[model samples]
Each structure stands twice: as structure tokens, then as C-alpha cells.
Target: MSTTTAPASATVADAGYGSARRRDPVLIGLWISLVLVAVVWIAPFVFIVFTSLKTTGDVMTTGAFTPPATVHYQNYENAWARGDFSTTFTNSVIITFIKVPLGLFISAMAAYALARMRIIWGKLILLIILFGTMIPFQVMLAPIFTVVNSFGLIDTYPGIILPYLAFGVPYQVFILHGFFSVIPRELSEAARIDGASDITIFRRIFLPASIPVLAALLILDFVNTWNEFAMALVILQDAGMWTLPLGLMSFQGQFSNDYGQLNAAIVMTVLPATIVYLIFQRYFVSGLMSGAVKG
Candidate 1:
């Protein structure tokens, strides 16, 4: 009996070892796939940086992969000076700054009321907002243009900003509604028992807890507004009022295109938001997961 038990124990130990050995190749394959994905994702940005540093002659002569014989930092300098990006950058910043906070606050308030406060037609209101998400921007463009033109908002910052806010609010509201719904009712009830007003509860308790969702929403809204081109193109006729996307369009001439300068400008345009995402990536991920899981 003892000899039979010893062989059985040895076989079990060997089986466990074999299982671990099999998992090793799976882990290795997963890691290799991840590395490949990372390289593919990063390669374009790397090429852009290298191309931006190359001279027009070098860019036209050698492929972007070839290391520059001498780095020409002048491409960036020329692009910055010649491209009128200063105004473009400022316009984007202003639009983003105004839109994000306003959108978040309004959306949060609407979401809170919709989710927490039992009101008539609450479900209908939510349905309407959700339905609006399905409507394509292109469909509304003509009507939006006529309205903006009537208000004399065309060629003005408000023209661009108001539309962005209007369209962005519904999506923000939808996301925040899901988040607000998941907040423990007990917490809000406790606040009320302590004589806190709804506004006070929202500001003190809900807002603080909802920071991650807010951060994620803010990042999404900012990126969307920053990269918006078609609306800006149609609405904004003034060159000085152009955003980065519109400004980049000028790089493509009727007869010729400045690929080097265009690449440089593109790099500059993307850098700020890229840096922002890198910095807040942790919060963004956490916020998204929290909202998704809790909702």
C-alpha cells in the first residue's frame, strides 16, 4: 500500500509540473503578441517624429526609416513660425476649456436629477437623449448652419463652442446617468438626514466620488472638440479664427503639398493631448472601469 501511494504522489507532482510548463509557452506567446501590438501602435508616431526632424530634401530623398545625416530642427521652427498655429492652439484651448467644464456640470446635474429624483417623464427624457445619440451629425449640419447663421454666430468662437456643447451634452448626460445611478442611495439619504440640500449633497458628496468619471468624460470631450474639423471648416471662414485641424488643411496647396511641414504641424497638433492622456491615463482607465462596472 505504501509503495502504491508513493507512485501516485509522484505522478500527481509530475502532472502539476507539466501543467506549469505548458502555461509557460502560452504566457510567452501572449507577451510576444503584446510587444508586437505596442510596436505597431508606436511606429507611426516614431516615424512622424523622425520625419519632422528631417529636412525637406532629406524627407524627399531618403525614406522616413533612414536616420538623418544631420538633424534639421529647423522644420519645427519653420512650421511654428509660418503655420499660424499660435492662434489655432489658443482657439482649441479656449474651446476645450469652456466646453469640458460646462458640459460636465450640466450633464452631471441633468444626470443626477434624472437618475435620483423621481419625476414625471423621466424615462421618456432619458429615451429622447439616448435617441439623439443615434442621429448623425451630418444630418443636423444643415439645420445647425441655418440656426447659427441666423444668430450671426458664424466666424465667432461661440458659434463653434455652442454647437459642440449642445451635441456633447447628451452623451455626457448618458454616461453620467449610468454613473450616478450606481452611487449608493444610502449615502445620499445620510446626507439628507444631516439636513444637506440636494445641491449641497451633489457638491460635497457626489462630485468628489464622481471625479474619476468626470476626468474620463473631460478627456473624451476635449479630444473630440480638439480634433473637430468639418464643422469648423464650414462655420469658420476667417483664417485667424482657424483651429489646428482647419489650419492643417492649408498645408495641402492647390498645386503642391509641404509634406515635411505638414508632418511637423501634425506632430505639434497631437502632442498636447497625447501628453494629457499620458498624464491622466491612470485616472482615465480607473474612471472608465468604475463607471462601466458599477453601472
Candidate 2:
């Protein structure tokens, strides 16, 4: 048979056309939008890093975005001591660590009952939870404070932790219930057939399979409990019992603000949250993707 071949120029042109068509316009636009948004979002952090290195006077004289000619490592040291962060960081850590685990366990139990077991008014309870999430935390602040005060729990770890658990549980339960409901019923049914108790199945089957979900929630609850300020402000009046957020108030004096120390403190405050987010970033993203795929 006689051979017939296209010119190299025509082949190259055809390949280029195919490659251009493969780059979807919508996807390209989305990437551009995301890059622009990321730059805008990161601007504040960049400004803070720059400001933390500058002196209070320099902040006024120089622009917000300007880099410092002389870096101030002293700012971190001053902020650490003046802020009294040791006590506050310990208090915040204790509250967050204790509350996150307890909250997760409670939420998982509730979600399991709602998702897997039959119970009277379970759907109604779930509906209530769905609505409860929409209610602002500010709405419950007065009642929570009143109850904490009545119980003489002010300035105690339980006072703050209890409220955190109460507010955080509903959303955790909602997410867990959705994830649990999508899991195959046969797994639990078979475990039941083998004479396993509900708790056993929860521990052995459901929980083991829900690692990504649990890890994501763990990170989220930890961050929330750590960053919570309003409830802590209302509950913890004792300086020894204050959390990091409360400790930040020390930066603002009656006459002037310590911009250097304030920005440094802000950076310090972000460290733990950023570390946690980085640690669980894998599970967080996977868990969300799993839910999206399942749904």
C-alpha cells in the first residue's frame, strides 16, 4: 500500500489545538480567581509579619506594608513576658484538649444513636440539632454565664469547657450523623449478629472507619476551643485562669498601644492553630472530599 503522511507542521498545529481545547475556560477562570483571592487573603498576614518587626513609632511614620529597616526580635520576648502568655497558654491548652476529646465522644455517641439505632423522636432530635446550629453563640452567652455563676463554676476550667462542649456538639453530631448514615448497614448488622453490643460496634467498626471524619472534627474543635474569647471573658475573671485571647488585651495600654508586641502576639497566637491545621490538613481535606463524594 502507498504511504500517506501529514506534514510535521500540520501535526504540530493539530496537537496544539487539542491541548488548547483540553484547558477548560471555566477551570482556568476558577484558578485565576483562586490565585487572586489567595493573594488578598495573605496580604494581612504579610502586613502583620512586617509590622511585628517595626517599632511603634515606625508603624506611624512608615506605611503598613513597608518592611522594617531594623528587625525587632525583642518584640517577641517583650510580648511573651508582658502578655503573661505562660499561664494563658496553659489554660487554653488544658481547656481545648479536655473539651475536644470529650465533645467528640459525646457527639459520636449521639450521632450513632441517631444514625444507626431506632429511637423514639430521633428524627425530631436531629431536626432540633439542625436548627440549633443556626442559633448564634451570642444568644446563649447570658444563659450560660447565669448557669455557670449559679453553679459557682466561674474561673474554673469546667465553666468554660462545658459551654464549649454544648455549643460545639450539635454541628459535630450533624456531620457525624451524615457520615454514619452513609456507611453500609450490613457492617453493624453483622456485628450485631455476632453478639456485639452497640458500644462495641461503635468502637470497633464505626469509629475505626470514621478516622478521617473524627480527625477533621478534632482539629476543628481544638481550634474553636482555643480561639474562643467571649465565653471565656464572661466566665474567667481570674487572671491566672485567662486564655490567650484574654491575654492579648494586655497589649493595649491606657495611653498607647504596643503595635510591635501586639502584632508579635498575634503571630504567636496563630502558631498553634496553624500547626494543628497543618498536622490535620490531610485528613481534613480527605474527610471533606469523602463527604462530597458520598453525597
Candidate 3:
């Protein structure tokens, strides 16, 4: 009797070939979708960057999407000088740094209380907190302005930050509460059994575990604070105290005829937030799942 068998290498190769062929359609579809999405997402940024390099005449004659015949580097210089970006940018940085961490700390503590501690009317308090997220920004504008004016805080950093904190805290509390809810109660109990205080457990365990979510929130809050125009406009009447957004609005009138310089200002306005996002992008994906819970 005789038997024939395929060689080991041949068998392995055939299996791999078959698997790849079976997956070919899915892989091709995935690649196509990614390419399409990338092009769509990048299109506006490309348009802005290209438009920013064209003179006003180039912009008008060459059409919106057309590349400039001659690159204009002076647009950036003109934008920075005319927009007063240096001072406005510094103002934004100070405000964002002050508010984001303060908001996060307050939110995290509020979340810990709601998720971990037993208190009278805790659920009622949480409902009120969650309800704050639903209120429209416009609706709060008058009240906030009134409160700030009554306290004589207008044109000051505190005037801007206090209202921002009030508007921003509810959302942070909502998210942080959801995340803290998923953290098993047993972990806190175990720490308590070992004589760890509530603050100790929070600082040593919860905060360390929550770094990814906190980092994600840090970037979001930073962007929001940086780009915030309405509140800044309402609170900061003094030109010297204006943030980037307010500066941009006022500067837009100066560059009305110069689209290149206008777009250059836009780029500079968006650049810091973009840089912050790129720096913290790794944590963003994992932190997105922070509020999910067990079935």
C-alpha cells in the first residue's frame, strides 16, 4: 500500500492562502472606507492651508480650491501683528490652564461623593447636577452676566472663569460619575478595611486609575476653553483682557480684503488646540470608554 501526503510547507501555505482569500473582501472594504474618511476629514484643513498662502487677487481669480501661483509668506506675519495674537494667546493659555484642572478636580470630587458616599438626598442632588447639563448656554447668559456684574468682576479673569466653571462642571460631573460608578465598590471597601481614609483611596487609587479619562477630558476642556467666544465676549470688555476668539472677531474687520491673512489667522487660532490633541491622542481612544458600564 502506498499513501501520498502534501508537504508540510505546502499545507501551511495553502491554509494561509485560503484564509487570506476569504478575508480579501473585508480587508479591501475596510481600506477603502478608511481612505475615503481620511480624505473627507483632511479636505477642509488642506483648503484652509492652501488658501492661506494666496494673495487676495489669487484667491479671487484662481477660485476657492485652486493653489496659489505665488506663495505669500507674509500673510502669517501680517496676521500675527494685526490680530495681536501674542497677548490674546497668552490670555487664553492662562484661562485654560486655570479652569480645566480646577473643573476636573471639582467634578472628580463631586463624582466620588455621588458614586461612593452615602448621603441624605444624594440621588436628588445627582439629578440636579445632571439637570444642569441640559440648560442652554444662551439661557444662562443673562443670569451669568448679571451675577458677574453684581460682583464687580467684569473684565477680570475670575469673571470669565467663574461662569465657565459653572457651565462646564455639570458635564464633567456627568461623565466622571458614570466612570466612578463602574469602579467596583469592593476596591474601596478593601482599602477602608486596611485603614485607608476616603481621601487616601481617592488620591492613591481612583485618580491613578483614571489618568486616561482625565487626560482625555483635559484636552477637550482645553479646546473648549480656548475656542470659547460667547462667554469671553460677554465678560471681557477690555481689549487687553480679550482671549483669542474675541481677538479674531475684532481682527476679522481689519483683514476684510485680505482673505489670505484671514485664513492665516484662522490657522494660528486653531493651531494650539490641534497641537494639544496630537500630544494626547493616545489616551483619547481608551478614555472614550470611560462612561460605559456592565450589563
Instruction: Please list the C-alpha lDDT of all candidates, in the order they appear.
Output: 0.85, 0.87, 0.89
Give, for candidate 1, the lowest lDDT window spanning 10 residues: 251-260
lDDT of 3 by residue, 33-93 (tens): 9999999999899888998999888888887777788999899998999889899988998
- The sequence of per-residue lDDT tens digits that candidate 2 reaches over residues 1-295 is 2233557667899999988888788789989999999999999999999988989889889998999989998988888888888889899889988999999999999989999999999999999987878989898889989999999999999988888888899988888888898999899999999999999999999999888988888888888888888989989999899999888765554213778888888888878998999999899977755534433
Q: Indicate which candidate wins on lDDT.
A: 3
Off by over 4 Å in 1: 1-17, 254-257
Candidate No. with top TM-score: 1
Report RMSD (Å) for each prediction in the order shown: 2.8, 3.2, 3.0
Q: Name every residue pair that clashes in candidate 2.
A: none
Winner on lDDT between 2 and 3 is: 3
- The predicted structure with the larger TM-score, 1 or 3, is 1
Comparison by lDDT, 1 against 3, better one: 3
For candidate 2, the TM-score is 0.87
Off by over 4 Å in 3: 1-23, 60-71
